[model samples]
Target: MKILDKLPYFIVAAFAWVAIVSSCANQGMPTGGPRDSIPPVLMSTQPEYKALNFSGEEVQLTFNEFIIPDAISEKLVISPPLESRPSILTKSKTLIIRFNEELKDSSTYSLDFKNSVVDNNERNELEGLRFSFSTGDVHDSLRVAGKIINGFNLEPEEESLVMLHKNLHDSAVYTLLPNYIAKTDKEGNFLISNIAPGEYHLFSINDLNNDLRYNEGAEKIAFADTLIVPDAEFHAEADTLTQGLDSMLIEGHTHFSPEPFFMRNFTENIYEQYVKKAERETKYKSTFVFNETVIDSFGIRPLNAETKDWYILEPNEEFDSLTVWIADTTLAANDTIPVEMSYFQLDSLEQFYLQTDTVELVFTEKKEESRRGRRGRNEDDEEEEGPEPVPQFNWTTNLSSSNFELNNDIVLTAPQPLAGIDTSAMLLYLKQDTLQTPLNFNFTKDTAAWRTYRIAYNWEPETSYTLVIDSAACINIYGITSKALESSFKTRAEDYYGSINLDLNNVPGDVLVQLLENADQEEVIREIKTDEDGTVVFDFLAPDKYKVKVIYDRNGNGKWDPGSYQDKFQPELVSYINEVIKVRSNWEWKHVWDLTPDPTFIKNIRDKELEEQQRKEAEEDARRESEQGTNQRQQQNNMFGPGGGISPGSLRPSGR
Candidate 1:
């Protein structure tokens, strides 16, 4: 009876052991094989690579492993560009390219992957894969390679479109698309392959609207005057292989050894003339603003012949702008002034033509309007019109030269016209211990600028002085009284400021030298045009680190012109000296720079900057890749086996 009762317990123990073993078998993960490191390999093509007389509607490429396309449309470059971009599709491990436009007869086509294909799981990229096909019997195996640089700064022009023109006419680039095109890399390097062996014109443009046309004044352009022939020598060489299936022997490829062509980019600014606006502040003054400075070939005539004598025309140096001063004081205050202006204006075709415009000038607030009442207004109704507003104004003293150059005088400007001043209420004193010495000074209005006044007194270095003006000391044209004012200042010490003596070598006349503050060469502290012998001196500069920039003025204009494409002008060259000069108190810093063009020196500077940028990007990519690998490994270890094992099926051989 005891043995039979223990039988149920034994059966229960056996069932419990079986359940525990089954659970353990299902819980553990399988150890995976080595992590995938090789990129997808191109096994075969439907119409073999470099296929001659190809007539297929679609091209197919079979890879050893499944691939995921990343920005394939953007990275793929098609030579002898199609009217419509082709469509790309993937089915398992095969990549399909469907033509959207008819292929040109007797033309060679090159499709470049530019490393857009990568393995699906590990995302390892395949580099430098290309396919070539010909619609006729033979293929053009030549290439044109070059570098593009900014004409002004000599910096690398990356992402610029380099084009080849078969028309060979200068005007053709403005209207037609290029025959073949390639984009410059970060290092300003570009190579267009499978070009026919013939003379071809080369040009580069930013292609802002992606139209491939040179839109005047809207895009930058770089052109090569001489035609190019793609007949350079090419040699075959074996490519270095990586680990895994990539280590297998591959066919050698031919590489072209072409002399690098250098190009400079520039933009043209064509002049457009038009009267932007015209302003009339008083009956005596009229200001005409042109799109640009106009110095001649423009006229303003009064509608009434008798008033013509009053017009005094004066144009600024720019020649695009002008101001008219009327000397006639007998004109009525509220008169409707009619005037006719004739000038050369730019038409839609950018051609200059004589155009006339009639304008009725309006002056809302005139000095005479406040002095006289309307013709029908009664004197008794003045109270209803409200008491005239008190003529209020602000005054500013031109202390720009207050650091007190010996030749500078204290200049004060008032918004309103000044009539007279009271010298008795004004005092000047030299600040001395207890006994302040009284100094003699003179005050007078400036002849040229009627609203400006000059206060003159002899100044000595390191001396403090004070000027005081009592209230109502000065009177204005509207009989307004002056406000009380007091000013005190001391001359700077002789050793407080420094100087810079620059010796420019090989300067092509009309260059501008500027002393710039800060490390970025901004904030112009002082600037001057080059004198004879290329000598420039800057005095009275505070202690600071300064940089120098020299602008090569090509047109002998005082200002630097960026450039204009329509005018066939290149921007003036700008050269920066490498050193940051430290100016010390009471010290003079002398610098010598050779402005002569040095091709090698300019290239080295640009190359160093490019290398630094590339290094940082490479480091960032490596860091991300390392992190991804670590996270993947950790996840496998936790979910699968301890050694991060994967199922055996995932390690199926990638047949190449």
Candidate 2:
């Protein structure tokens, strides 16, 4: 009752309590800032600042801000590492490091804080902060500086480790930490400070295996032939070391090696007829058998059955042997099929070699009879039942060459010798630009079974010329009319010519050079190989600017191949210098290319182009959607506006 009488005082007390609670909630709230400003900066260390004869088990460091430890283990590195890792303690911005093992009696130790210490707020790293302590009276402060380059391209290889070893043995790097070590930056520059003056072997390693050691099979190592140290000034130049391919490893162990040669024999005189019919009819069965130990896989090259021809077949992949299956009807009854087989194998020097062989097979009469029985009877039996007429032999004109330049001499070759043909019945005409001209012919025998007649005529440049053989030009042994054939080709002008010269310098002693033009930019101009002088010349090229490239054919295989990663084989490093030489009329452009070192600029350009293409595609898609939306809106307006039978003024609001 007495408290109720003092209501005004009680109300005042309650209001004051509410205000205090609201003020406390608004003040001192967690705003995600550090508990204190000035993140962990090192002030001073123990042992009285560079005091000599220091043999302390515990070292204390004072900082200006509260410290949190996360990357202490990875960022901290102790030179001549201790048997065990040290312990770090944080007590109110004071970091204390306690050694867990005994140190050498009179040795110097350096602690590198490699981006380890960071502020708690934004995780700002402290760079290049190191502390040095010595048990001896003197400190080793001598330094060395240099750059690390890739031996292949003479370009700086970033993040490469440059190490110095007191001993040059293989196990030195594996067992002991480098006496002095530094990593190359993006510019390939490195500096090792506080190195003890001594004779040391210096080398740079890619360290792909992360073992901190050199493995020729897994790592690229650049070593100086001589020793380097703090007292002696030296520079280390690196070379790209290429590992050879091992022949012991086989690729795709499933198939046998393909044979280079195969043969199909025929008894009947159906060479031309069978070739024409076989091209349309895909019936035939052929099997290939080869040495499984010598090759990996094989394929058959296309052949001309009418005229005994030779063709080259390339292998698909690496294998000991390969078997190919072909249909039997591809050959005539008396035709012989010639084949070339390609094989791949590793040589003793750990290099790959492509081996080729030639083989042949004869088509016999028995095989032809078996094929006829396998082929079912056709509907043509009704027409053949009426009368058995004498088979008519037909003669056809086949130009031995299908494609030719206008500068080349025109030659008409016949399949058979013209002995019984009437000379007056033959008519040959050559025409160009509506101008008909008669060509004088001179007959010459090529071989015992074939003959050719040469037609002389001066071809005009940049003009399409056609040769026509009228019907009944020559009669065959069976007295049939010859089929008329026509061929046409446009002549190249004198202005369409150019040349290029390659000058290679500092080439390896046993390397072969191959020059290749970008096919997408130009037609198949030509391919040339370099001589011992490392020079290749390409003449009579069509007038065009082309992308030129070269390959250091290390194995003399006459081809370029990408090396394998598992075998520790670096690819055949190709280079495109990006120098577009314009080949003009009557111009001999000489390009001095030194392919001794590989180039990576082309790869960079290709990657950039790929990114640009992707970006353009995205932009095009956005534009296409915008256009589609515009078209849809226009169609909707046309359907509802004036002429579309829905007047704008007559339309009313939906709510109304």
Candidate 3:
């Protein structure tokens, strides 16, 4: 009873404590006064910055405000990089850097702390805090700056390591660490300061292992064609990759040659080619997946079975996967099958060697009762006992509607590969005003697909046509016959379609112009090669919005080839015309596409769209990760607590 009576006193005490805390918080809270726009100011340094002949392992930098030291390990750039990273600790408002390894004597050392430290109150970053000292009397003070981007998409590559190597051999990137290094920002912009004046080989790599050296076949790289010499003269150069940095400014010396050099990064096509896996997903389908593209010279054969045309070989467009459909039912019925797979394997010195391995293909399906029962139910909701339904012979066609498109073929697709297709049982007739007349048409199976057949005929616009197929017209490999099908559909009127006449400006003739259904390039609607004058006409496009991409077709293969670095070949250059052609009925849209390669133009057009798309995907990914309890993201709200992180919405330093 006495404790219950003291509840009022406790409540009063809590209220008093909250008032006192709120009074303390009010002093630091924003109150419409001039916002704290300035970053933490440097007060002094231990051993003083730029002290010569100093033999010390510890350096201290005191700031005007209490600063966080958490991001030092990641954002610090110590050139000539320390073999081991330095440790950073804070005492009151001063940060101390302790070297873990011995520094090279008689050499200039630069400690570039790029926006790692932030003020305690506002969390404002101290941007570009650079300190330099030399064991001897000399200090290097030159730099180089550039932007890195993906060669294919022109997308800016963030966090890419830009390296400067004095040893200009091609093997330097393979065996040695960079003399000086800087990481690209979100806009792919990088600035390496306090570099010694000398000619250097500049290269950029994604640095997958953070070993500072570019591991061929494991990393994407970009390099300068010519040696770059750092200078101290301020050469005016505009940042071309992005406009995001206009919001913030930075104090920098323009003592760099080729300011803002555009580097197009590319990943080599040489990766270890191993048998990724061998699996039999279906009774008749056995698939072999390779880690890299199958170079058309690979071979596979059954280890203990007949090798004479025992299976049908089907490779995907990328040639990375091969589907082996069993021709012999006896072989497919077996529970497991062994096959010898031979493919090219890469060596450490970039030489190819043939590797053979035995792989077992296994598949077994467990049958279970259907969770989804019959559509109709009994009053008691009991399982209805009835005769089992017969297996259906499944087939589909492109004629989904009565109004068929003139540009489309009446494609017939089976659920499984076909054993035989009898075109003699199929009939097509053209419907006139009242009478119908039989027409000659070619019904042939597609070379690439075993189960797909197309009925090709001269379809007259605004004319009705009738197609009839007998019950046994097509038979699958499983001995199931197709059901009888009949349909009367009318070809769309000529006015219902649209036409596109494209003039490929600045492009050579015979270039392939592909009509893409979407920006992702998952599906290509139509493809046409330009004429000798770089002109092409697509006369029968349906009224729909479409995107256009041009394939250079350098090898005259008529298909876009993903290039090989070992062969010194680049993927057929594809240029996307950055506009959606909204075709309306009875319209002829003529457009002149500029095929000239302008990465800056593409980057500018794609920046907002890419950011929006990535943001949506990142949000969805974050939500899914959070729901799955696997997200490890940690936020540092250190104003009233302790955190070393400077996250988004925190005060970041100016400039990319």
RMSD in order of candidates: 10.9, 20.1, 14.5
Tens digits of per-residue lDDT, candidate 1, 1-656, equal: 46676677666666665665465463657758888889888899988878899888888999999888656777787888777888999999999988998889999998878778888998998988889999999888899888988776567888898999999877888988789988887788888999888878888898898787888776888877677777855354544563356465545555554466877787766566677879787756778988765556687776765764665565656667676765555542536678788888778887887889998777766346444464566767776888775554455775532466543577778655556778888777875635656678878877655467888877777777777778777786556777777777777677878888988788767788888875432677777887346657888787887777777777777766665545454566777676566778999988777877443234332234446789999999999999999987777565455444443333333332
Clashes (backbone N, CA, C under 3 Å), per candidate, total: 14, 38, 0
User: What ranges in model 3 sit over 4 Å off?
Assistant: 1-38, 43-54, 125-131, 233-256, 295-307, 343-355, 364-392, 402-406, 427-442, 448-450, 457-467, 486-501, 508-533, 536-591, 594-602, 606-656
Task: Itemize residue pairs with steric clashes in candidate 3.
Answer: none
For candidate 2, the lDDT comes to 0.54
Ten contiguous residues with the weakest lDDT in model 2 = 269-278
Task: Kindly give the stretch of ten consecutive residues in candidate 3 with the minimal lDDT sum.
Answer: 647-656
Q: Which structure among the candidates has the greatest lDDT?
A: 3
Estimate the TM-score of every prediction.
0.64, 0.40, 0.71
State each model's CA lDDT, in order. Answer: 0.74, 0.54, 0.76
**lDDT, candidate 3, 235-263, per-residue tens:** 55555555576554433445445666877
What lDDT, from 0 to 1, does candidate 1 have?
0.74
Better of 1 and 3 by lDDT: 3
On lDDT, the stronger of 2 and 3 is 3
Candidate 2 lDDT score at position 647: 45
Best by TM-score: 3
lDDT of 1 at 112: 78
